[model samples]
Target: MRFLPRIVTFFLLLPSYAWTQTMHNKRYNVLLICVDDLMPELGCYGNSIVKSPYIDSLAARSAVFTKHYVTVPTCGASRYSLLRSTLPRTKAALGNEAAKILSDPETAIGNEPETFIEQYRRNGYHTVGIGKISHSPDGYRYPYAGPKSDQRELPRSWDEVSFNPGKWGHGWNAFFAYADGESRITMQGEVPPYEAADVPDEGYPDGLTAALAVDKLKMLARQEKPFFMGVGFFKPHLPFNAPQQYWDLYDAGHLPLTAVPNIPANINLASLHNSAEFNQYRLGEESAALDQPLSDGYARKLIHGYYACISYVDAQVGKVLQALEETGLADRTVVVLWSDHGWHLGDYRVWGKHTLFDRALRSVLMIKTPAMSRCKVVNRITSTIDIGPTLLELCDLPPLSQADGRSLIPLLNDVQDKAWADVAYSYYNHGISMVTPQFRLTRYFRKEQPVIELYDHATDPLETRNIAERSPDIIRQLTPLWERGNTGVYAK
Candidate 1:
């Protein structure tokens, strides 16, 4: 009887042992790198001027997404959508506190949506985050001055949420601080829109963020379990601050200006603003206006500063990637680099991201999986929210139950698949825009007047003219897409 019991125990243990071994052998790690306000302007994306050698080199071994669009133009709202794999459910979801608000048990509904990072942490992975992964850069709740509270922004998402604010005392300060540690709030609109300090990368917060991520990568290398590490860089977003070396790389004379700087014809003044965000920096050479254009010299200077910031962020990315190689974890890691949303250099006489145009919604997205080949580009219309589900699929994890995004695995596996969604959607305030291969249709529920805007991408890629008056048939066809994207909200 004793021998029979021993035999049965051994048989039962065999399956469990084999399952453990399989899980151990096939566990793939993830490194998610997020950049703020980055568009597809790297050399890899055919922008010959931007000096982004590191990101371009990484793109050579990754799947570059050419037409990836975010659900919203602002950073916090877009990041929230990416993390939850869902669209914004309320107007609060479009603000800087979107994550903190949506994840609260008091405010959230239906058992609360699970962030992909939380999902990984639950499934035996060592999940970590540093710098601006959420609305709060430090991953904690803090005020402007110092001493962040222990309360987490995403409560249960990270095993380790760490950041080094460097010269500035805390995350929010560093977010708006310059190379010399002078913060924007302190300056109170006294500073210029761009700066090129004669200092090393450490003079900015991103360099410190890179160093900390590299250290964490080293620590995670010794552990036997897998890791999902997120590193978010804040640069090229505001202040356009970069090391002087990066700024020196670009010549102001040769930098290109926006081909379309005027507002579109037959458009309501409500459709565009006077670039209030850019003008808020008091030291700017000129205040943006709808009735006038910025001086050519001043415009070139701003573009030059934007390019320098891109290079600065690119250098920090290179350092973190190098650490992965040094730790001998490169082959086992899935690398994903993306931006929160796009920014307008001079498009439509606007200088910020609070618009429904492609200039504000189209962002840079690239991924390099362990099984992916080198230098592949996918030109399909994809959303930023699709990333969470794609990572889950690649890691062989179960699908997220509350996810509103579809996996991009099909497109990654074969770029020519025809079953993908042709339209990409974006929303801000009371308006929603649906972008298809042929047209971008937008509608606004304004109390003053009913507005409809349509632009044919094939002919008016710059959106310089709205053809809604002549394109009635196109509007009827695209209205359903716009309605479906709105999800029954803001349709009045």
Candidate 2:
């Protein structure tokens, strides 16, 4: 047998995905920042243009997962899989309403504490969730344009779950709110796709969420219990709106456009869309379609709005990080910054996240622990489901049985870990896509011409073409590994 050299590792490994290392006797707290519809477009992710200074600074000291993929691409389903430490098994589980099951009367019975937050809360951690941590902006069950309900999205997860709707009157309204407190849901096709308001950061709901997070940190800092805090910021999602100052940070005329703005080769149109979600903004400059690309001017303008939203949210994150330092809780807390999923800035002529392509499935993830070695990029593939277990291990809490997620604590010890299984799974558009370091194989459960699509990342990093038709041997070898991800949840 081949031999390898001895190596050092974290001393507190125990059980499956459990770690007990600690900083003195103090309990470790967590501050989770959930950013909506964000890709790895930050400065640290090698996007030379998108202004994400705060997140970049955090990435400088954190274990950044460059290949982190979401179980689902949409905001709600992705977050549902994230909080539950599971993958999508049902069609509903792949939708925005997936979190409502946590409070379901009949089905939620016999659950293992509903969500990871509930797991923490049950174990004496003071769990606080604000903004859109689990689907709903305010953690409540309500229609997009209906009256607010007392029902909680994850009924037993957090000790306190909340969000301020500001002038929007309700959480759903705030989610789609404009600068004038009107939402696209209520106004119905009247709003544009983007906005740049000449107002302060507080003019946006995300700004208010940040201020609330800062306040909560200040309050939680004075407490004695170990805390689990989720701070969600809604920006760079839709109807991209931010303060004028953040908007001024970019020049639309000089913004970069998607290199491959047209559709990919040989994939079915069923795998793509006519940008129906982006079309909801009826007053936008131009509509995005699979046939042709958006005008260069309009595309640049949309990119400008997205970049501004990112910078605006980045400022809010900076505020919360500063609050942690000011409250003297920075040394005892683990900060995990993640985006629910990625977005298409006209990538492959798509403007949304409902597809199962790499552009939609891959997102940004960074975990910053007090004892972690200075900023390192873990090139290993990781899944969103792994986050919950990683948080448990990082905070020295007991491990829970997850659907497929494993502990990432070991990766912190060695970024180039050969023992790591470099594969991540995602489900959406009635399909399952698996991403490895060298390949991406997608199997769609539909009657499309090309049910199997494969992209070799080693040579085609841009995923320009599908080579599955020609690479029979590679596909045959990879199929069994990809099949492991099905797990009966995506069964018909």
Candidate 3:
């Protein structure tokens, strides 16, 4: 009788063992779309004013993370955490040049991988990078060299780093390019803050990028090996230039301005900064100030520019996603849309990122796996550090040993997974912030008064005021959580 039971168990395990082998061998493609300076103010996110139809369509069939945050508010540092799946441990790890280690000739790619893309490359996947995958547009260090320079930002990660500059001479020029074939750099601070060029989509670099991605999808579809394609869109970031048609989609006068325009009360000036990044446009009609808010007219106009750029990007994104479907790769591909970090669109009297506030740290995160049948809202707090492991798991690739983030497969399976932790950590402006459902606690490293701050999301979701002084008991409860995040910021 015992032998008969053992034989039955062996027969039952055969099907499951074959299924496991198939899962490991399955070739699932990845389409990673990285947008710069995009906030969660999309139509899908319940924003009434924005017109993001293409992204909203993707969100309809995807897992939209409502509380997705980045490890840093800046571009490169946040992307560093996403690519490495590791938290920032040193001051250099928190800077924009953090990923330069992957491209620097002196640095060696040893036994460990520097990025998830590299890991994917190792496991028989063809990786292609387009547009601004790294801090440098076109994945090259063109800012310090000529257009024809050969310097690379992520040299070994991608099989190829390519882009189309359109009318602009090079990638960097295309990034800051205007319709007149001149860029912000070439114009030397003489250009205005925004433009509604009367030209086709090809007039902007992102348009060219979308076209290139579409063409690449056709090529990748014919290849045997699975591929990982990263399409980084650079728009709605600075100079907010888009086609006039997109700008016409909104009435600037009726569009809503930011809530809580001034810096939050009870916070020191050291915790905030003057709008230096926004003021870089010397010819802009109005300069942003910390002491006062921008004029209503200017603020509305700027918001209009931002919205127009978003619509423009939305159309470009539609073209790429459509190409995926046309190529017949949509069924087997895992598509992910994420932003490097959120931008301060006149929120907190600041016009850019680099703050630990919610607006600056939170951005768009949408994932559409082939197995998911309908849209699901993931309400738990997730971080950029979790993206790499999630992608690897979705693709059934071996996990990277050095990643600090946990796979979000459980949340993806069950949107309201009770076993999941609901906290996300962010670092910026010499501060480490812990984000939960009801509160945000921050501890600053600088020698300023009121170095610790807390915001109650239930009453003041906009973070209009700091209640750390009045809520002593809450601070005591959140301090341990804040310290737990602090440990990740510093290496032992």
**Per-model TM-score versus the true fold:** 0.92, 0.95, 0.93
> How far off is residue 423 in model 2, in Å?
0.6
Better of 1 and 3 by TM-score: 3
Candidate 1: stretches off by over 4 Å: 1-26, 109-113, 145-147, 448-450
Write down the lDDT that model 1 would get. 0.82
TM-score of 2: 0.95
Top TM-score model: 2
How many pairs of residues in model 3 come into backbone collision? 0
lDDT of 3 by residue, 1-492 (tens): 000000011111111111112234567899999998998878878776789999988887777888899999988888888998988877777888878766665764467777999889999999999998778778887552345578777766899888998778888777777899998878876888899999989988999999999999999999889999999999888889999999999999888878667789999988787878778788899888888899989988899999999999999999999999999998888899999988788888888888998888988998887765456777789999999998898778888898889888788766567888889988878888999999999888777889888999888878889998899999998887777777455433
| Residue-by-residue lDDT tens digits, candidate 1, 199-264 | 989889998999999999999999989999999999988889988999999889878888787888
For candidate 3, the per-residue lDDT at 242 reads 98
After superposing candidate 2 on the true structure, give the runs of residues whose Cα lies further than 4 Å from its correct spot. 1-21
| Ranking of predictions according to lDDT | 2, 3, 1
- Report the C-alpha lDDT of model 2 over 1-492, residue by residue, as the tens digit: 001111112212223221224686537899999999987788878776778878878887677788899998888889989888888877778899988777788678365878887888988999999999988999889999879999988889889987989999999899998888899988997889999988888888998898899989989989999999999999989988888998899878888788776677878989888889999999998988998989988988898899899999899999999999899998788999999998888889888888888778888898988665356667788999999998887666777775468888778776666788999888887788888879999998888779989999888776778899999999999999998898666576
Q: What are the Cα lDDT values of the candidates?
A: 0.82, 0.84, 0.83
RMSD over all Cα atoms, model 2: 5.6
Clashes (N, CA, C under 3 Å) per candidate = 0, 1, 0
